[model samples]
Target: MKGRFHEKAPDDIQVFFPNPESEDPMKDEVMWVTVIAHDAASGAFLGILLNAPRHLKDVQEGDNVVFHLPPDAPLPVAVGMGGERLGWPVTAADSLTETVVRGVRHYRQGRFGHNPPGIQACVGTLGHVLEPSPQDAPADLRALGHFVLARCLAEQYETERAIHHFEEVLRLTPEDEYARMGLLAELSVMVHTSPDELKSGTELDWQERYLKQMATALERIKNPHSLELLGVIFSEEEIKNAAESNPERERKLRRIGAGAFRYKVR
Candidate 1:
């Protein structure tokens, strides 16, 4: 019989049953066999049929038997089944969407603490599967994957990578407030860190232009957090003093600062 062993055997090896359509005389049989266990150093194996093949009872425990796997058999099932036996959760039965969903769940659960390698591996696998595009997966799952990846990168202090993923999340879901806020926060960090780079004339010019553009964008958002962030990146003192002289602008900045607590807490 041609088949593959399902797992390692000590005294008895469990083998997969060959397809019934094959030329084997016992094709209609649904029987299995446990090969007699041999020492690890020995290459010999013996098969003991569990059903129907009583004639094989004459076979000695030390007798060798050949097993063959069908050419058309799926390899993923074997690999996934083996991995499951070894304690990994991944399996051939899991779809790409299902894998990504499990990754997201793992990410969320480990986000607040030190993430283990397994969780990182799960999320990284999801990224590889989803990257370039989500293929047939749902658009929302893709967006959620990006969002989770962004947060993971951010927590790992990979700011630029995190920013890229966050931007991707926003591109897929423009109305995602959490991603928008995350983008703003990352931009704020970039602005905060740019002061040293500003000594270079080209970099200084770029910083100035970026700050102005972001300031305008924040004004359009009218969100208190964005406004507060803008005030920090721009000139908080200048705006506050100017507001004192201009009643209308003063009310606007004040309203923007309303309920703003991060800067205060810091």
Candidate 2:
């Protein structure tokens, strides 16, 4: 009646129970049970739930199944259950800084797609860092926090909020290439999604301003992805003119593009 369930799967274990009256357990009616255990300290009771199975198997009631648990096993940490599993350390001693770092890692790994729970977890973690005045926070932490917040908002299609966060990151760290990249990417989306708005002189001016900013950032950072993005945004004539004026820039762009394509194909 008392037993521990060994975690054979990621979160739960499956156990089959047969009718006590059945002579052969495998051939007769069997009850399937699913056990889910929290990653807590040892000596805790594992959660047991009955499951319905399409086909009956040989298992009998009153059958004693024994499972072993280490007496001093530590509670399992639940930090990396969702997303890209960046292997961040999650413990009782973890600080807000650590949680922010983990959330940033999740955002960078592109793990927020169609995963609301994971997104919510990351948002909660990063929100703690931003609850106080960001101005009082360390510059690096503020930049990182804003970047992660922007990324999470973008994932949820909260465009304006994401843009504000990305701009905050840039304000905190002017040379923050990631923030510039994020801002430009979001602006690009806005341009595509609202052609009528773009036609307005003010919106057009805003687009041009951000595009120039993106070009400047690309020139300084030379990030391959940013370079590719710039190439996509500019016309062939514009790129050719710029390349003619800056041959080295053109060469770097071509080299980065080729390398990116090769790696992607591989």
Candidate 3:
């Protein structure tokens, strides 16, 4: 009755339900989960509610269910009456293994799409780093491994390493909007906005118009459709200010467009 639930989604979204007594916990109670899937291609989203133990209790073999949860979200366990399989790490391990093998195969075939499948490979490496898994990975995997690790670090607010990862990703895909925006967002967070950072415009109206245009570009890039293709042109300061001033609206816009948002310089 005291186990955790584990689910993994593509990109940086993973969820775990921890044992009640787990150390360094985030939440105490195992409540209902609401998953929102933002389209990696267009940022359009559709979400669903998941009922804890009860929902998964009926899962059968060969069920084509796409699980969604954070890497560290806690799970629940049921009693014997529910035909529960307790302490079974192999189920999760098998899922992890398949993802890695598939990722490597795709990477070798140059079919890694645009992102190089770091999120999947990172999940495997994360398992090895966290547990004593017997995954025989190679040295070259380190490059992609480091990329995902850096993204994880960034999501956790580790500014320095995230920036480093963005740089590396940009090296591989020069026109990558995500990496470029990430770098700009982080820089905006660390560095103060200078008047010189603004474009050369003697008139006040011209400066305002320029800032608004930059802000509009930032909003457009938040859409995954625009992001993955040509990245929008904008000043980071204007984007940061817009994001900060309209936090709620911006978040809703981000969920609709994809998961892109300019991190406020807070």
Candidate 4:
């Protein structure tokens, strides 16, 4: 699945339905779905079951099911339904930038509340751009996509996944302060802090590699929250040295809250 698999006007998907006929209480029947259209009010997709029910009784082929989009999205391309399906040329679509914005919109909408539905849509839409192997996509959109995905993952404590996405954004723009800050913070976790990131044998811990630029990056952002994050890993002296003589920087650094990593540099 290197590129978009569902470009055809009518996309088909596979979803899990319980197999009522199976003796086991937990067996799931794989069903093929025909996506009809987006339902605006509920944020759920309306699809028709293409398979005749084998384990289901109340519904049969052509029955409708309103489903939440799965987290890994672009609606998985499904088979088993006999028909001539079309594929949209990978290059023919030109709304990628706008699509990225749409993803951000969804992310913001779902970023709050105990349960957020929009996050699913956010991941799916941005994931569409990602599968096309984002290397050739617009840099801003690509970085934005990775950044948003990274934030979503980090909040859930999916540390490694979040690190990978944050790295993606930094790769496109090494000067990305926010992404670097994010990557550094994530790498500070107990597992990664003790090991060198295995790439290129740099012999530099991921935290240190990012920290080499910390002062400059912090200067750029000038947000006190950044000082709070760095305070947890770097020693107070190291932070002060990095802050240099800028009166405001010193002021911010002094206000950094207390906390330190297991490997906090003294």
Q: Pick the candidate with the highest TM-score.
A: 2
Clashes of each: 4, 6, 17, 0
lDDT per prediction?
Answer: 0.49, 0.51, 0.39, 0.56
Q: How close is candidate 3 to the true structure, as a TM-score?
A: 0.30
Residues 1-266, model 2: lDDT tens digits: 23333445433444333333346656433232333333355432233223333443221121112222344533221111222212223332235555566565445344555556556666667766675535654677667777877878777776666777888888888887778878766655554444464434455555575557656777776678767656664655544654676777565334322111110100
Candidate 1 residue runs with Cα over 4 Å from true position:
1-94, 116-119, 194-266
Sort order, lDDT high to low:
4, 2, 1, 3
Candidate 4 local lDDT, 1-266, one digit each (tens): 23322456336666666444466855546677767666578566666666775656544564455555545765442222222112111333357655655665565556432335666676677766674445666676678778877766665556677678888888787777778777766655522333353443232444355455455556665557666656554567765675777777555445431222221110
In lDDT terms, which candidate is top? 4
Q: For residues 42-94, could you state the per-residue lDDT of candidate 3 as single tens digits? A: 32222222333422333222111223333353432121122322212233444
lDDT of 4: 0.56
Off by over 4 Å in 4: 1-93, 190-224, 232-266
The ten-residue window of minimal lDDT in model 4 covers: 257-266
Query: Residue 224 of candidate 3: its Cα lDDT?
Result: 72
What TM-score, over all chains together, does every model reach?
A: 0.43, 0.47, 0.30, 0.43
lDDT of 1: 0.49
Task: Provide the clash count, candidate 4.
Answer: 0
Prediction 2 global C-alpha lDDT: 0.51
